[model samples]
Target: MASFRKRGCTCEKKKCTCGAKWEYRIKYVDRQTGKTKEKSKGGFTSKKEAQLAAAEEELKINQFGFAENGNEVVLNYFSEWLEVFKKPNVKPITYSVQERNVRLNILPRWGKYRLKDITRTEYQKWINELRDHYSEGTVRRIHSIFSSAIHDAVHEFHIIRENPIQKIKIPKDVENTNRVQYFSKEQLEKFLNSLKTPQKNAKYKHSIQYYVLFSLMARTGIRIGEALALTWDDFNEKEKSISITKTLVYPLNSTPYISTPKSLKSVRIVKLDEQTVKLLKKHKINQNEVILRYKNYKASKDNVMFHQHDGRWLRTNVVREYFKEVCKRTDLPVLSPHALRHSHAVHLLEAGANIKYVSERLGHASTKVTADTYLHITEKIENEALELYSQYIKF
Candidate 1:
């Protein structure tokens, strides 16, 4: 609560302009610290002006924890939000995305507005304007970052009652969002064959590294980062299971680092078949032979399964470019490295594999994610399961 008080002079050295001196004084408990404090400001022309100022002061203190009279600007608060909330707690890659999104998208649109001034109607209009300029996915990402920051501003800073963004509907064009494509068995084989076949002016006699990398992606439906992160130690030849605990994150122009896999579900032991084990064993033997051919080139102790010529960890971009060249050589469908993973999922589902087991094998956080991704295969698999179940139920 706040009150208007008359700032009467002491009648000593200062002039006795008691009638002209009125001050707004607020005595309130700090919401965060739970401590009592008093704030006062003098030089108001009259008691009525002081009273109005005192009321505004009281409202600010009670609601948004405003100590003085200024509103927080969006850019200033977002920077503070990152330093206080995002930077300290989030993963490096996660922070990188947050920082980049804010700098590129959110800052341009909403940064100039004060927190209190950006209303739901104007923000909604801004979002609708984005659909024509940006894809649904990009717009959704921009909104997600903005909404998350506003969430913090309310909870941590007490800047607003609720996130106004929560009331807005996200523009989700389902057809645009789900563009993941996969290849058939024949197409995949043709793509793989193109890799092993010798190309003009290539330094290596055969594409052993490219073949192994693509095979790994096909066999295990793991993300490229997870596959690249594999070490010799991760594969248990005896058990035929590989431990997937880490992922290689090679951000553009930044030093590569290892991070915990995409999610808790991704940190799993994925079983490998005997044929794959044999292929891997062959690749390792060939890799070592290549290393020995170089002058004084002892095989690197890094133990990374897929490596560069010097046995260092391979960058993802190098692998992507290599894959692109291999695709150009073949008549098979031109697909990204990630298409190998999608192909694995689609093939398993088409072959009457259980959705639950497939979900676990693919390291999906939930079966719903697997079902959602491979929606085309759901009914066919379910029908196959029903027929198989009928044979067992002898009633």
Candidate 2:
């Protein structure tokens, strides 16, 4: 319904109304493909401004033409397109992660370019450059963003004829660079003993709680975030089980947020051994004492199992720092909080726990992942089969 009409503009510098006038118009058209396109033209006081406005109008026309009627698309328009198209469809944690990757890695490189203009060769070159600078995992994640955005552009928006990154190959799986760590029984005892060292300083009396957190992680194999998201209600003293239904995640530049488990299987109930149950009972008593001592202050409803002395949820990074400190104090190898989960799995497998039980305990989607990840522990099973074969053979 846009009508094209020209309007005159007077210029003070020219001192002539007719000679210095500029024309402005708006036009709408239906393309042969049945797509509606709108174009606008505007005059400015200066010729430079007029040219800039004309170029802007031309870009708008191109953007409109790329999509069908009532459709709009702009690739790598990070703020606009991501908010309108991607954010609503994904979980908060996923949306936050995508936003971070787009802002930090993808957008800085590709934001200015249109989807149709980015060729596979150019994307390949960009990925190669990233490979030289970033880790393989980081490069792969960035490529995922590009692929997802371009795929949406092609299929949903009809903005591009094809996805240029459709055939681009990602690198083969690289061995995880992260060090594999498992606690020796002796080392774990030594670390726990170190945590029991009484703090002479009255300000830091919750050191034992730190030990409790470590022990829980080492015994339960729950993710640090999942542990942090636990509340009093999630635990069942009578049933002797802990329900893992939510996880706490902090994306870059975002506040800590609660998200559902990574998969349906991740929502699980893990039985607590008597020792772990006793530890939890003691932890509850300790938490109550701390709450009484700090009754003057308010606390959040989340009331995480572990908290700062001030009663705030313990930040994940802060926990990592404390872990490092504990290792240093105990003269142990540096280990991440997640290493405790791995240690738990390895120890359980070494104790002759079956693969199915291990998988269920770890809340894995299937037993295959548990078996694959812990293939080292299955060596005994293999040896048993070999021994059976040897018994049948008489040479």
Candidate 3:
């Protein structure tokens, strides 16, 4: 219950004749102490405003058993919510992206605003501004993080009654056809061949490791993190398969660590080709020789299959940069290391491999995902199948 009173009123009976501000004193039983406690706020221009503010407070108390700080800054509340609810449950790399979005996108726009005071119109305008600046995918990710946090505020914390960012329009992104997302079969061959070619200015002495590393990705369609997390123990020599159960979490702002794969499907066994198995075996021999030459050197704690000379996990950036260099030297289109995974998938699909098998090999959640990602390839395959049927009917 709340009582409204006029402040600094010289003549106060039922209504004040003097122009005075209004205040409300709300009394509620604190659930923790089982005792009556009072909360009061002042400086409202009218009695109605004071009563409405008190009613909002009462609603929060009734819903959540306590009144949250209605004046809490948006950034401060979001930071706390992210730390308390999000960080522990998500992967380090995923948490980093959310943290970055809060800092770069959300905080700068609404940090200083009171958490309960943000209006829907203003939020929609801000979203529109963001859509103009960022790609649709990026804008969606940003919006998702912000909207998720706000949803918790409404339903979980009862900090706000409604989400301001709900149903905001996002502009569709134009596909950049000129940008190369993956390598052609010939380009992949050239890139892999160049990985084995020696360079005078190369920082890493063993170029064979690069060849084996990239070859594995191009053949297996595993993520770069999954490839980096491999250990000798993961390989089955007789079966010629590699088990993928974990991935490397390489965060730009923190130390790298090993974590579980992206999903349950990602924890699978990928069969290796005869040539790939031979390449890995030969690389193992070379690695063993290097270890034998330096008896005093210590092996990496994780015993990862790929590492630097000092037995540290190879930085992801180093691999990406070197991959670009290899592409340039081969006169191929410069693509990220992840392009190898895409190349592998494209080659498998183009070679008449089953979509389900490709999905499983790529560790996708479903064949639908694989089909959607390579929709153009599926269309091409459809056309080719029809052409083959037409040729057969000519007899």
Highest TM-score against the true fold, candidate: 3
lDDT values, one for every candidate:
0.79, 0.72, 0.84
Better of 1 and 3 by lDDT: 3
Model 1 clash pairs are none
Give candidate 1 regions above 4 Å deviation. 1-70, 174-179, 294-298, 383-395
Name the best candidate (by lDDT). Answer: 3
TM-score of each predicted structure versus truth: 0.78, 0.74, 0.80
lDDT of 3 by residue, 1-395 (tens): 89998878898477677889999998898654467879899999998899899999888666545335455567667777788789989887898999999999999989988877888889888888998789878988998998898898888876677787788877776675223378888888877877676688855454378888999999899999999999999999899999999998888967989999999999999999999899899988877776666655446677789987788888899899988888887888888998988889889989999999999999999999888888888889999999999999996
Error of 3 at 170 (Å): 2.6
Worst 10 residues of 3 by lDDT: 63-72
**Model 3 spans with C-alpha error above 4 angstroms:** 1-71, 177-180, 292-298, 390-395
Q: Residue 37 of candidate 2: its Cα lDDT?
A: 49
> Please, what are the lDDT tens digits per residue for candidate 1 over residues 1-395?
66776666555544455455788878887543467879898988887888888887677556555322225677776776776668989888888888888988788887877787778888898898888788887888888889988886777556666677677876777573564678899988888877776667866654377788899889889899998899999989999888899999988788889999888999998998888888888888878877766554446567988877766688899888877777777865566888898999999888877889899998999999999988767866777779889989968
Q: Arrange candidates by TM-score, highest first: which order?
A: 3, 1, 2
> Cα miss at 187, model 2 (Å)?
4.1
